[model samples]
Target: MAKTIHIALVGNPNSGKSSLFNVLTGLNQKVGNFPGVTVDKKVGSCQLADGLNATIIDLPGTYSLYPRREDEWVAYRVLMQQDKEVVEPEMVVLIADASNLKRNLLFASQIIDLKIPVVVGLTMMDIARHKGIQIDVAELERELGVPVIPINPRKNKGIQPLKKAIEQTALELYKAPVRDFINNEALAPAAIGSVKELFPELSDYKAIHYLINHESFALHGHLQEKIESIEQVNNFNHTKTQAEEILQRYQRIGSILKQSVSEPSPLKKTLFTEKLDNIFLHRRWGYIILLAVLFLLFQSVFWLAEYPMNIIDWGFGEISSWLGNVLPSGWFADLLINGIWAGLGGILVFIPQIMILFGLVTILEDTGYMARISFLTDKLMRKVGLNGKSVMPMISGFACAVPAIMSARNIENKKERLLTILVTPLMSCSARLPVYTILIGLVIPKTMFAGFLGLQGLVMMGLYLLGPIMSMFVSYIARFFINIKEKSFFILELPVYRAPRWKNVLITMVNKAKIFVFDAGKVIMVISLILWALSTYGPKEKMRSVAARYEQQIKQHPEQEAELNRLKNTELLQNSYAGLLGRSIEPVIQPLGYDWKIGIALITSFAAREVFVGTMATLYSVEGGDDADENTLMEKMNAAVRPDGTKVYSLATGISLMIFYAFAMQCMSTLAIVKRETRTWKWALIQLVYMTGLAYIMSLIAYQLLK
Candidate 1:
């Protein structure tokens, strides 16, 4: 066992920080929330040039030390050790975008002055060269008094050199600057000198920060009192001092970049990104392009998943049939075949869709197009009592509302932020994918539309559409009811488009699929097994009476054996515990065109909406027995018959169900996350009440009109 060198990688957004991380850690990274915060903290292990293990923490990207958003604060806290839990960084890797050296150096300069050992990993040198910009790495290094390594993580160049620099810096082979870009003593002499007495080890730069954010630092009694007294005596002004500090840093950085870098004359060329954004960012056409992109995304989920989904469905069916034939016919065999395999298969079949959806999303993100979506949607968001920042969480809700709600912490406006959290779940998350895909396939026609589009795919697009439309409508109404007057703003950066990294895309696809299969699979399996038990056994006397009644009927009317068996299964199901509960609640949901089968699903899906398909698979398998092997879940659901002999999956019933799931607060994980983020059950309960009520009303109206 050996100690690992702790390193923090800090950079501006779009500085190729994440690309470098991916290259360093590959699939070795683990993502978790920072202690007591919802923002993600990504950690990974990589071997240094000296063959020693090192831990790399990729901090949230930020432009400066002052933080307006929660993510920015996370980086600030770790760098400042504002929390007791954060591991102290032995070395800081400042990733500078070579293409944007001037602005990048502003943050780079800030870190060097923090008195920590630093190694500057200069990235995008080729991009800078392509733009007719040249950087004198030696000059920049000499000016900043830190080791500068030119690296391209994408091309796997200079990584060894960067690692070597980190190792040397950690070993004190490279010395940090004794004096940084700005003279802190000249700016705040009294406060800096006084803070140094309280903490002898404090650098002039560290003392300045202590003066500015001393309230956040771990200080007690006389130490804190002395710092406050110094600030008061010197008339320290935070806003004025920060502005002065930034101006001074930039002034010195500007002079250094002036001699060290060269750029082409302005009249010679324009960036290719600007040329592309011209059309993609057009006021009128931008909206149209965004709509088409979303249309293709939802359509692709169904269009691309069909082949793999069919394969998975067939594969699971074969396994279940083989087990049934090989194992003796009994409760254990029945449980393995119908209970476990059926539920697990129903959930697994949708993994293809989940992977494809997430893969495309990751591509959009890596290529820097996702930011454009948020930028384009800002106007529409504001009209709904939110700013463009809300679009990030809203789009994230398409994957899952729990993370989406957590992301809303970046929203500075309390009213808009809360509104975003409350309405985020209305976006059709992938959990609802199984429910939507199955229902749409069962009820919607399989015809082609306009020569290429499938009707079922179009129906899925429609299901996704309901999420944003209803979210806007809800946000509009909510804005009027919940009054808060905090001003909101939207400032987003659109990074230059680049080829998406296929490796990152694959990783995201695999991770999302694994999470759905392993995480959701666990819940679906336990619940399905419970459901199998409830649907299999009931009160002893009632079960005996049903068995006796069916046995006599079968013996007396041998010619009617086929029909008798169907009745026997149906009657037995009705007498079972789940059946009794479903029947009791059936009257309440009957008007929505739901039968006991759907009622049971509704109850089970409260654990998670993805469990809906699992519940159906188990129910249908328990009732069908060997028929379950020949017919897929969708086929079985489509052919389902009610007591009155009508098809259970009528178009009206399917649409009503889709509408309900589209708006319902069906995910306990989402509800729990909401509680944790909002810090009170009050808002969570309000969210639960309003969302469930809306789902019920919308479903009631849809079923009544369509049926």
Candidate 2:
């Protein structure tokens, strides 16, 4: 059997790295964490030949080999062969942005000098051409001493040749570079020679890295001490050496580019991207455009998803009715319909909204407006003790907080990163989407203003916006107490705007829906079943007494048997174990306009916010029984009433409940991720207490005022 060839994909940020990865791997990819770190490891396998299968590891993007952030450290370790846990790649595919050649080549040149066999895949050629930049690919290849393949990952162009180049390079059939990109050995001759002597396998470039980053490397204590001693004896200045190395490499790059590349003079060039940025990034109009964009996004979620969401709701309701008639009437049948099916339906019906929401967010990111959003919000963020970098994580929080918190690792300032993590959960995630949709549908009118602005969508947007607003307020107050002072900087590279990739958008929608189904779905299903059982059976004597009394009542008045049966179910549920648990908390939550049923949802939803919908579906299903054959969760919830015969989901009650879910830190997964990211349970517990407490107080005030 042929051994699987290992290859690493390295690139600078926004150099089409992810796009190329998606094109190469398609659906044959899996995400996992690198050993001993929470950084995401994206690995995929592709058939390079009939007998040759290659595994590709997509490393985090970095501007240079020098590591600062955790992600950069991970990339540096993998490339330098310092991480023992990872398999060292036999070859590397270095992605470089053609439009940003000068900056991109800095990292590319460093990789080439590491002595790793590499193929350069140049991306964004169209963008480069739009900017009036011309490149001689053959001449550039000859200059760099490596085969260069210009690839447009968006259009799936140049992939076959790129793959072939990678194959040839990995097989060592391609001619190797005759010399290094720069004279690495001449930087510090004595220290480089000494380090290389200690480790014969290391290249001149790798040896220098060890001298500079030995403290961070996984070297043995004695080796670390030896390197420190060498450093002290040679008076090696890591900073000066790094500066010199960069200067020399760039100087060589300038000489190389002079022969192989050309561009319009900077004074004469006004690219299409600049023309568009004039409007999108305008000081005054930018904020207005951003709001308009977000408004459209939220409105589109409802408008486009209306039909599919309704179809899903109707399909589930019909299936329930069909099962009610077809299945044998028994506890098993009841469990299947009300316990499992109800949970599944509750979770699945929101798939359209989830897909649309994610799809829109993906478009914003693909179009490169996401970076602009960060730039636009930097001023506002810094006022609250954060900077532009915090906006990405907070925006990502809308999709999910688990990954959002992890993304905070990119923020260089420790205090800012911590602050970003602490309040990010407050940004309403998609888990809260189901809760928001159902409540907004319950209370907010679907009427449109001037046939465009939907009240329901407006409410949804408000819920989404409320999260960041509250997060800012919390961050401002928390900064004073954090007690860590550091100068904050916000430096961002705005990518040239381009059209959204539809394939990527579709994939994002599907993946997000799957995550919701399989990940959050598990929690919802379990909670639904447990809730079903608890709502169905109580203390044995109380259950028996309730059943017997109902039977006696039915015998006395057969004409009222339907009403009597309904009453019995309601009373029996009130006496059941689930009802008892809910009632215990009802007193505390009543001020928030939540009764025992909503109380039960609150308790079960602590596992996950989306589980509230499933819990309510299960509870109401058990309580309502087979009285309504084709009743969807929304219908059941809509018809529910309090003891005074008032609608349970009145405007005030719905608003309060929405507010509660808006502020509550109800996800255990989020809590666990916080703990992992912070490496302590203290922050996690604090997050839970403060968020839940704020939810309670805010919910109480909203309910009282509205009532």
In candidate 2, which residue pairs get closer than 3 Å at backbone N, Cα or C atoms, i.e. clash? none
Every candidate's lDDT: 0.82, 0.84
Could you tell me the lDDT of residue 496 within candidate 1? Answer: 87
lDDT of 1 by residue, 67-151 (tens): 7666787898888867667788888998999988888888888888888888999998988998999999899889999999999
In terms of TM-score, how similar is model 1 to the real structure? 0.84
Which candidate ranks first by lDDT, i.e. highest? 2
Give the TM-scores of the predictions, in the order they appear: 0.84, 0.84
RMSD in Å for candidate 2, one decimal? 4.8
lDDT value, candidate 2, whole model: 0.84
